[model samples]
Target: MRAAEIRLPGVAPVVVDREVPRAGDGEVVVEVVAAPVTPLDVLCAGGKSYFGVPRTPYVPGVQGVGTVDGRLVWFPTSAGMEPGDGSMAGAAVARRSDLVELPDGVDPVLVAAAGLSAVAAHMAMTWRGELVAGEQVVVLGAGGVVGQAAVQLARLAGARRVVAAARSAEARTRAAAAGADAVVALDTSDHMELVGRFLAACDGAADLVLDPLFGVPAAAAAHTLRAGGRMVTLGASAGRTCPLDAAVLYGRSLRLLGYTNKELTGAQQGEAVGVVAGAVARGELVVAHEVVELGEVTGAWERQEAGVVRGRVVLVP
Candidate 1:
């Protein structure tokens, strides 16, 4: 089996020939078809994330769609957070509990590229954000794959209005095309200016905020929330530390909730995957991505790490 692995921390993964991983008891050996380069994979290989330092010479894929004994499925890897290799290979050993089998008609590569990210956005709006029909939504970082999924999911979840904020003109255009009722171009360098523009675009009010950019965008979106509104933060794409006015936070009686794919129980994760994959199957959701071969993992990996790519990168093995 040829696998892309990181031999040490703070290094890029390299493709090497290695023995195929064997499944232990209660686990399954999956023949990988498509694996997406995700932030979790990048952060873990860096040896510094909530996942902590990873063991050297481990595979660097967090999730992938594959076939377990001929049944197609998706599985997540916490190798960066644990002691194990992952699915960036010809085959992988996955826990039975973590597998989400796909329907027969679905595209495994598209699911691999879009499923997990869609789950993050879908869960943020429905479960953690507690968004309801007739409520207004503001999606920050609405350009990345997750962000694009969020803009559509927010509308599908019954939001009366959906406003998208992104830094690039292309991103903002993509956001609008993805179903954001309105789009705001957030100035990457000016935090306060970004906040002001978001508020203006949203008409100074919103009921729910699905934030992926935690630093400047988060703080700016905070001020636009209506009194007693809620915000669910899922990632820190722009920056980690966000400054918030105590008065705005306290006086408005707002709620700030944090969510991540790691927090969901196995059953919940599986259920979310089903919903997301079903939406894709029905054309309710679609993800833009570039397909790269296994040998080109280095370039795809670098694209993900640079944080410049606006679409999902699926590695087909």
Candidate 2:
């Protein structure tokens, strides 16, 4: 079997020949099809994440779309989070409990690209944020995979207006393409200026916020929320600590919530993946992504880590 091996921490994986993995009692062997180079994979492989340094000389993929007993499925792997090889190979070993059967006609590469990122967007907005129809939504970091998915999922959930904010012109364009009602640039450091831009774009206060970028953007978006509005944050690409105003929270009685995929049970994760796959099958949800062969893993991994890719990078093995 051929796989991409992370021989060293904080470095790209190299293609190497390895013995095909054997399934254990509770595990199954999946013929890998498509694997995504997610931020979590990069974080874990960096040896700097809270999960701590991972064992080296291992495959580096957190999730992938593959076939188990000839049935198409989406599965997650411990990978860099634990001492094990992942889905970035011709075959991967995954617990049967972790497999989610994908819907018919859904593109494996697309599903792999969206994967947990889309699940986070969907769950954060509906389950954690309690988003309702006819509500206004503001999505921060609207160009990334999670942001792109959140923008469309909000609309699919019947949001009356969806405002998107991103740090780059390209990101803003991608947000617009994802059906955002209005797009705001996070170019300025002036918090009040950003709040003004968001307010102007939203027409009025937003009822919900899908915030992936913390720090300044999250703080600014907080001011755009309506009284009692909810902000569900799932990532901190902008910054770990936000400069949110205490007044904004108390004065408006706003709800600040956090979300993570790990908080969901196997059933919840499976259901969310099914929903996302259904959306993709219906062509109602699409995120920008680039596909490359498994042999190109190094370049794709480097590009993803450097934020040079416009969207998620899927490696087809």
lDDT by candidate, in order shown:
0.86, 0.93
Tens-digit per-residue lDDT, 1-317, candidate 1: 99998898878788999998877899989899999988778888897676688889898888899987788898887777788998899998888988988878888877887868899999998999998999999999888888899988887888889999888888888898889888988866676787778777885589999999888788888888999999999988778888887898999999999998878888999999998888777777887788999999988888889986668888988
Misplaced by over 4 Å in model 2 are none
Q: Give the runs in model 1 whose Cα sits over 4 Å from its true position.
A: 188-192
Best candidate per lDDT, number?
Answer: 2
RMSD of 2: 1.0
TM-score, per-candidate, Cα-based: 0.94, 0.98
Spell out the clash pairs found in candidate 1.
Answer: none
Question: What is the per-residue lDDT of model 2 for residues 3-31, given as tens digits with 9 covering 90 to 100?
Answer: 99999999999999999999999999999
